[model samples]
Target chain A: MTEPVTTGTEVPHGGTADKVFPPLDPSTVSPQLVWLAITFVALYFLLKKIAIPRIGGVIEERQNRIQRDIDAAERLKDEIDGAMRTYEKSLADARGNATAIARTTQEKLSAEVDRERAEVEAATAKKLADAEARIAETKRKALSSVGDIASEIAGPVVKQLTGKDVSADEVKRALTAGAGE
Target chain B: MPDPIHQFEVKRLFPLEIFGVDATFTNSALFMVAGVLLSFGLLMYASRGRSLVPSRMQSVAESVYEFVAGMVRDSMGEQGMKFFPLIFTFFMFILTLNMLGMIPGFFTVTSQIWVTAALAILVFLTVIVVGFAKNGLGFLKLFVPDGVPIYVLPLVSLIEVISFFSRPLSHSLRLFANMLAGHITLKVFAGFIIMLLGAGGAASAIAPLPLLAVLGITALEFLVAFLQAYVFTMLTCMYLNDALHPGH
Candidate 1:
C-alpha cells in the first residue's frame, strides 16, 4: 500500500489510477472471474481424475513394493535360520551315534581278547603238569640202574677179599639203603 | 519504451461476449488455460510409466505429490488427504503461472488479484460450507477463543469476526501483491537500464549497475515465485484444518 503512494507521487503516469488498482477495472474483473472459474474447474478435474491420481498411484505403488520386499526378506531370513538350526541338530545327532558305535566296538574287541588269553593260559598249565610227571619217572629209572651196578661191584670185591660172595638180593638191599641215606 | 504497467493490460485474443457479459478470451484467460494445460502435460508425462522404481520424471512428479501430501497430512491430519486434489491443483496452477511469467514475454495469471481473489473465495467457501456441515453451529466457537473473561468477550469476538472475514482478502492479496510488486520492480529497474543506455556517455556507464540489479532481482523473483505458491497452498491447508476441527 505504501509502495503505490510513494511511487504514485514520484512518477505520475507510472502509477496511474489503472496501475494503482488493476483489479478494480470492471471489465477485467468479470472476465478474470469467469475464466478463472472455468479453468480452475477444468484443472480440478484433471488433477482429480488424471494428474494427481497417476502421481499418487506411482508413489503408493513404490511404497507398497518396498514394504512387501522387506517383509519377504525378513521371512526368508527366518527360514534360513530355522534350516541352520535343523542342520546343526542333525549334525550333533550323527556325531553322538558315531561315538556310541566306536565305544561299543572297542568294548567288544577287548572282551574277546581277554577270553582268548584265558584259554591260552589254561592250555599252558596242563602242558607243565605233564612234563613234571615225565621227569619223576626218569629219576626212578636211573636209581634202579645204580642199584644193579652196586650189586655187581660188591660181588667182585667179595671174591677178591677171599671167599665171601654176597647174594644179589643182599647187594640191592644195601644199595637202596645207601641211596636212602 | 513499454510502460511497466502495460504488461498487465488484458488484450482480447478472441473477442467473446456471453449473454451480454464480456467473457472475452483475453491474454489472462489464455495464460490461465496455458497454465492448466502445462500442468496437465507435465504431470501426465511424468507419471506415464508409473514404475515402482520411478524414472527421473516420475521422481519429480512423486516429489511434488509427497510434498503436498505431507503438507496436507501435517496441517489437517489424515482427514485432510481427501482435499489433496484441490490443494495440489492450486499449487501446480499457481506455480506454473508464476514460473511461466518469468519467461520474459509470458503473462502471469496469478498476478491478477481477480484471479487470486477467486481462488481464495473458493477456499473460503469450502472452509465455511465444510465447517458448518461437519460441526454445525459449533463452528462459530472458532471465533470465541476460550479462557477469555466475559468482560472481554464482546470486544474479542468483534476483532475475531473482522479477522475471520478478512481471510480471503489477505490470502488473495498476499499472492497477488507479491507477484505484481516483484514484476513491477523488475520492469522498473529494467526500464532504467534502457533509459540510462539511451542517454549515452556517462549515463550509459551506469546502465550496467541497474542491469546488474535487475539480474539480482530477477533471481529473487524466481525464489519468491515458488515461495508464494507454497505459502498459498499451505495457508489453504490451515484454513481447511479450521473447518475439520473448529474448536480452537
Candidate 2:
C-alpha cells in the first residue's frame, strides 16, 4: 500500500525493468477502479438498453413463431385425419350397397326361375289329363263298335249253325248280360 | 528473460488528472473498454439479423446470453429477472476480461486484487440492500439453520455470521488468485523454453518439453479463464438468491 503516487507505471523512474507489480501496486488502483467504473457502467447501460433486449426479442420471436408453426401443422394433420375418416366411411358404405344390390338381383332371378318351373309343371299336368281323357273316349268308342260287331258276327254264326237269321237287339242284350256278370 | 510480471504492468495510455486524482487511462483501462466494447458490438451485430434460424455467430452470441440467463434463472428464479441486466453485465464483463487476458502480452484487469475486491463488495452490498428491502427484518434469519440443536445454535449462528461476512473476501480472492497463479505458471513454463533454447545442444533438444508444458498449461488456462468467470457468476447468483429468499 506504499503510495507517493508517481506519474509513471514503474516506481523507478528511468528503468525499463517492470519492477512494480501493478496488481499489488497501490498507486494505480484508484485510476483502475475509476476507469473500471466508467467502462463497466457504460457497458451495463449498453447491454441493458440495446444488446440484451434485441437478442432476447429475437429469441422470443423465434419461439413464438415455432409454436405457431407447430400449431398450424397440428391443425393440418387433424384435418387430414378427418378427411381420411370420411373417405373410409364412404368406401365402407359403397361396399355395403354393392353387396345388397348383388343379393337382391340374385334373389329376384332365382324367384323368377322358381315361378316358371312351377307354371310349367302345372301346364304339363293339365296336358296329361286332357290326353288321358281323349284316349279314354277313343277306347270307349272302339269298345262300343266291338260290341256291335260282336252282335253282328254272333247273328251270322247262329244263322249259319242253326240255318236261321237272329235280331241285332237280341244279341246285344245277351252280350250286355254277360259283361255285367 | 524479461520480468515474468511485465505483462501485468499498467502503462498509461492517456493521462488524465481530475481534481488532483490520478484517473489516468492506462493499458488496463484500454483493455477493459475494449473487452466491453467488443462484446457489446458482437452481441449487437450477431442479433442484428433477428433471423428465425440463427447464423453461427448469432448462435454463439445467443448461447452466451442464454447461458448467463439460464444461470440467473436457476439460482435466483424468475423474481431475479429484475437483476438480469446487472447479472448479465457482471458475467460478460468478467468473462471478456478473463478471456482477453489469455492472449499473449494482454493486461489482465482481474489479476488485480482491487478490481475483484471492488466487484465482490458491489455484489455483497447488492445482497444486503436487496435482502433488507425484500424481506425487511427476516433477512437476518438467513444465518439461522433449520434442525440445529438449541444449545449449539449460538455457535452455529456465530459461524454462519462469520462465513456470511467472509463471502466477499473469498469471492474476490478466488478469482484473483486463480488468474494470477495460472498466468504465472504459464509464464514460468514459457520462460523455461527460452532458457533451455539459449543453452546449447542437449539442453535445446529438451526445450520442447517446456514448450509442450506451455501448450498444455495454456489450454488449461483457457479452461480456467472460462471456469473462473462461470464460478464468479454462479456465486453471485447464489448470493442474490439469498437476497431474494433469505430464509435459507
Candidate 3:
C-alpha cells in the first residue's frame, strides 16, 4: 500500500476499499438484481399500460389528422377542377352563341337590301314608258297643225297678190306637180 | 486526491432484509427507481396532451416513441411491433439512468455489471423464446448460414454457435464497461486538476490541461451516454429480428 505508484495521487487503488472492484463486488450484486428486477418489471408494466400507448396514441392521432387533412385538400382540388371545367364550358358556349347571332343578323340584312333594290328598279321603268307615249301623241298633233297653217298663209297671199282670184284647186294642183318634180 | 472508483460504490440506503436475503435497497437501486420514475413520469406528462397538434414536449415524446418504433420496424419488421413496449422500456430506462449518472452525486446504475447483465440476459431470453416460438426447431439455422463450403460448414457452424452464445456476454459487458470506464476517466481527469491545484505552485499553472481534458471527456461522456443506450436498444432489435427469422 505504501509503494510509490505514479507518486501517490496517481495511485490505482486495488487492495484498499474492501479489496474488491466496485463493479464486481459480490455483496451489491444481489440487491441490485432484486431492485433491477423490480424496476424492469415495473417499467415494463408502466410502459405497456400507460406510457407507450399514450404517446403512441398521440403520435398516431397526429398522423391520422395529417392524412385526413391531405385528403380534404385533395377533395378541394378536385372540386376546383370541376368548377374550372364548368366555367370553361360556359365560356365556349357564350362565344358560339355570339357568333351565331352575328351571322344571322348579316343574312337578314342582305335579304332586305335585295328586296328594296328590286322595288326601285321597277318604278323607274314605268315612268320612262309613260314619257315616251306622251311624246309620240304630241308629234302627230303638230304635223296636222302645220298643214293647216300653210293653207291659211297661202290663201292670204293670193288675195293680196294682184287681185288674181285663183281657184284653190289650181293652187293644189300646182303644189302637187312641184312635189312630183 | 480523489478515488475515481469510489463513485461506483453502492451504499446501503434502507437496510432491510427480504425473505432472509440481503435484498436491502441500496443507492444503486435508488437510481434504478429514479430512472424508472423519470422515464415513466416524463413520458406520462408528455403524452397527457391529446391534441391533434402536439405540443413541443409531446412532439419530443412522440419522436422517442417513433424513433424506437422505426428502429424496430427497420430491424425486425412490422411483426416486431409486439415487442415495442419492451424495447421502448429498455431504451428509455437505460438512457435515463445514463443521463442521471452524469449528475455529480447520482449513482450510475448501468455502470454495474450486474444491471447491464440483467438487461442483456432479458434480451437474450426474449430472442430465444421468440425464436423457438416462431420457428420451432428451425431457429438453429441462424448459426449455420447459407453458402459456406460444404467441408467448412462444421467449422462455420461452430464459430456461429460460439458467437451466438457470446452475444449476451458482449452485449452486457459493452454497456457496463463503457459507462464504467468513461465515468472513471472523467473522474480521474477531474481529480488530476485538483491534485495539480493542491500542489499550489508551478503545477497549478498546468492544471488547465486536465481541466480541458475533463471538459472534453464530459462532453464525450454525454454523447456516449446517449450512444450506449442507442446501441443497446439497436442490438436488442437486431437480436429480436434473429429470433423472428433465424435464417442467415
Q: By DockQ, rank the candidates, best first.
A: 2, 3, 1
State the DockQ of every prediction.
Answer: 0.36, 0.52, 0.45
Candidate 2: segments with Cα more than 4 A from true spot: A1-21, A81-103, A124-181
Error of 2 at B52 (Å): 2.1
All candidates: interface RMSD: 2.9, 2.0, 2.3
TM-score of 2: 0.83
Better of 1 and 2 by lDDT: 2
- Per lDDT, the best of the predicted structures is 2
lDDT of 2: 0.88
Write model 1 residue lDDT over B191-230, tens digit each, in one string: 9999998999999999999889999999999999999999
Per-residue lDDT value at A61 in model 3: 77
Best by DockQ: 2
Which regions of candidate 1 are displaced past 4 Å? Answer: A1-24, A98-181, B147-155
Which of 2 and 3 is ahead in DockQ? 2
Model 3 clashing residue pairs (backbone): none
True contacts kept of each: 0.73, 0.78, 0.80
- Candidate 2 RMSD to the correct structure: 4.5
